[model samples]
Target: MATARKYNVEAVFKGAPKKSDFKIVEETLPAIKDGEFLAEAIWLSVDPYMRLFVNSSNVGNTMFGEQVAKVIESKNENFKVGDYVAGMFGWRTKTISNGDQVRKLDRSVYTDDKLSTGLGILGMPGATAYIAFLSICAPKEGETLVVTGAAGVVGSAVGQIAKIKGCRVVGFAGSDEKVQYLKSLGFDEAINYKTMTSLKETLEKTCPKGIDMFFDNVGGEFYDTIIPQMNTSGRVAVVGCISQYNLENPEKGPRLNPSILAKELTIKGFVIYNHLPRWPEAFKAIGEWIEKGQLKYNETVTEGFDNMFDAFSGLFTGKNTGKAVVKA
Candidate 1:
């Protein structure tokens, strides 16, 4: 029998997740039956959404995450040995998958680059930014675009894509380093939300012409602040809200219905899972952008499977500038 090491949730998260909330356990695996493949995890993803996804009901379960893995052994004809797969296989060293909800990564998209990017720019985060901004915001050339969480995986991608569309992009990140990173990605302006006394004032200064599109990744006060500054008929894509993810009780949002009405803003909330059928399109476009040097990205990597929780918690603390992944 083969054994697998997996991180299991030991306690439900209270306010912020703690080290004591998770424990590693070993499990013995039986040989793969027909139509099954055994995969070894190479990289694991840590994103802000994970904090809200895990709840009391999932205690003692494997910690949830996506992984890019190598198929070492297979009984399924569709999944051959040596193929790379991306799946929601949680924080486990190995997975026995029957293919459901698993995607075989196209080597053409990744080339010799880090396979971990399947969990980053070329994966969910990529699709999130591509479809959400293009379809929802419908950015036009010469428009003004603002993105919250601008140094994060989706936000960084959003700003760069807007630049490609010839939009003037302003980004808000938590730290000075992240602000600089956004500037390097060609953002017109990058604001450090933590150090700024008034987010509204800084945004007013950067977006003097008013924001035509808002790609919101962090809600709460920042999201609220940007609403009143939206140009008439502006568009907003409501992505993940990392700012409120760790809270035991979500704070009450400011009343902004008046701003939406006055501006006639179009706001839509979306999760990338709803757009999974279009992932191939996103991959093609993002891959081309990468090849042509139109898109740039960064990753904050923690080098061990044992450090998975630490990497996950970094999403909330703004410790990561872009994608946060564990090199398993």
Candidate 2:
């Protein structure tokens, strides 16, 4: 028998999530059946999507998330004992699986010290940035690209990839620190939206050529403001609406239909899951970039599983500059 500790939903989220919304519970696990394996979580990911998804989750369901785990015991031939794997194992200390929705980690891609990258740049966020930006935006050399939420895991990757493609990049972030971080990543201009006296004016000055492509992670007024500033035939990838996720009621904003139509903008919303078949393509290219020193990433790691809620809540406050993960 094995004992597992997990976080369960205690109440549906209202506005931003509170620690009281989750409760930790412990349970004993049965012996592994044939074809099943048991794993211990090493790193757990806390993403913005969890806040949005929690509203629809039932009370008492384990908090849903992805993790990098090490198989401690196994009856499955494909997953040997001591194998490292990444999967949607929720926010649990341990998991038992028959290998569905699990992928063994490629040691060649990341060494043990860097296994946490599986939850960050070398993993889902990385793939999302690579595939969505390249495929949807179809960036061209000398094009000007703007990335909102530009210091985040996906956004930073998007900006760097755009740079690699010879696009001049302007990034918008919440703090001066993040602005500097975006600059360090080679953004041509980094605006701290909170400190800016006028976003519209700053955008116009920095992006004098008008935005040819927009990677929008923060939706709401930012999206409204940026859409009208795009060049003709611009492309917009609506990857997240994190700005609206915590609101009690959706914030109202000016309609942009005229700008969209007049500019002939191609706006599309995407769920990373929808592009599953192309994940390998993204990972392969991103890995090569990392090896060639064309890409860099950072992670804001919280030390304990008990602090998962804190790490998650921090996302709204601009506390993390890159990926936010919990070390178990």
Q: Show how many residue pairs clash in every candidate, following the order shown.
A: 0, 0
lDDT by residue (99-218, candidate 2, tens digit) is 998978988886898899999898899989998898889999999999999999999999999999999999999998999999998999999999899879998999999999999999
* Weakest 10 consecutive residues of candidate 1 by summed lDDT: 105-114
Report the Cα RMSD per candidate: 1.0, 0.8
**Top candidate, metric lDDT:** 2
Q: Judged by lDDT against the true structure, how good is candidate 1? A: 0.91
The lDDT per prediction is 0.91, 0.93
Assess candidate 2 and give its TM-score to the true structure. 0.99
Candidate 1's TM-score: 0.98
Model 2's number of clashes is 0
Q: Stretches of candidate 2 above 4 Å error?
A: none
* Maximum-TM-score candidate: 2
Which tens-of-lDDT digit does each residue in 102-196 have in candidate 1? 99988876655668889999999989999999999999999999999999989999999999999999999988888888888889999898899
Candidate 1: list runs displaced more than 4 Å. Answer: none
TM-score of each: 0.98, 0.99
> Which residue window of length 10 is worst by lDDT in model 2?
51-60
